[model samples]
Target: MTDARVPDRIAVRGLTAHAHHGVHGFERENGQTFSVDAVLELDTAPAAAGDDLTRTVDYAELAQRLHAVLTGDPVDLLETLCQRLADVCLADPLVEAAEITVHKPEADLGVPFDDVTVTIRRERAP
Candidate 1:
């Protein structure tokens, strides 16, 4: 038989946010800038042919949903944030799989760095 495991992929990058996501009190209270990157796996053949937005994943809508997730809830860890984002991406009917990453610029560790990020991947139930 031919290969049946070919995977489709879509990417949304440079998603930025400001939120209070951390363990420390200051981190929760003061908040900080956060960024996100997401990759979604879905069938694009139909959309490619029809050239219709409705036929495929909408990045704008996805970004808005991600924004809502970030600003709507408060979490204690980046791991939780990443998982939540993955859940959001997987909620779409067209999405078979998703990889999500959340980044924080001003971490509590007092290190000089651009950001700290967490990533997670998930697939829909077959």
Candidate 2:
């Protein structure tokens, strides 16, 4: 069996997008800014040795896909948004695992808070 210890990772941080997602009606109608951080686990040796783009995850493309998802649909919970983002990262065959975080800074929480975030980790099924 191949080693399951994926030691390499690609990180995309502070990705921001405007979208409509929340439990409130105004949130879905007006939309808000969402911040995302994605970490993908994989073996990068093949891409490094061959110096090929296809051998590794194209982060630019990944960001675009994530942006699309953020602006695509309206979800009631941040957990659902995180899951959708995780799904996009795991779509690549080279990605062994994905960690996703969705941040909502402008949420309508009555209490004062810095930010609200949801994080999730997903691994490819064996």
Candidate 3:
């Protein structure tokens, strides 16, 4: 018999990174800061009861992985970055699904804007 329970959610927010990723040449050469937010759907019940870090996602390590993607390559669109970020999150076999948002505060638009963000949600393939 299987429990077939929905997993608890774990969220990591406001993880910032400086990287050379953008559409314009200056934006790519000079680099800009990006803020990432991620949510992982996974079974945390075991970790909660046993007090074991191994049973759940290690967010610090996950942050490092997310940052690596940001710093590694230059992408023209925030949508691309969002998908790559989602891929990184879903790489963990234990993760059933991932929701991520990438925020670009310094977008090179002529008009004033508060912020620009792209969000994505992905579920593990069966």
Residue 5 C-alpha lDDT in model 2: 75
Candidate topping TM-score:
2
Q: What are the C-alpha RMSDs, in order, of all predicted structures? A: 1.4, 1.8, 2.3
Evaluate model 2: give its lDDT.
0.94
In model 1, which runs have C-alpha deviations exceeding 4 angstroms?
2-5
The most accurate candidate by lDDT is 2
Question: Which 10-residue span in candidate 2 carries the lowest summed lDDT?
Answer: 1-10
Task: Report the lDDT tens digits of candidate 1 across residue range 1-126.
Answer: 997977778898878888888898888898888888999999988899999989888999999999988887789989999899999998899999998988887786666786788888899999
Residue-wise C-alpha lDDT for candidate 2, range 6-104, written one tens digit per residue: 479999999998999999999999999999999999999999999999999999999999999999989999999999999999999999999999999
CA lDDT of each prediction against the hidden true structure = 0.88, 0.94, 0.90
Model 2 residue 106 distance off true place after TM-score fit, in angstroms: 0.5
Alpha-carbon TM-score of each model against the true structure? 0.92, 0.94, 0.91
What residue runs in model 2 are displaced by over 4 Å at the alpha carbon? 1-6
| lDDT tens per residue, model 3, 1-126 | 998887789999998989888889999899988999999999898898999999889999999999899888889888899899999989998899999999999888899998999999999999
Backbone Cα, N, C clashes tallied per candidate:
0, 0, 0
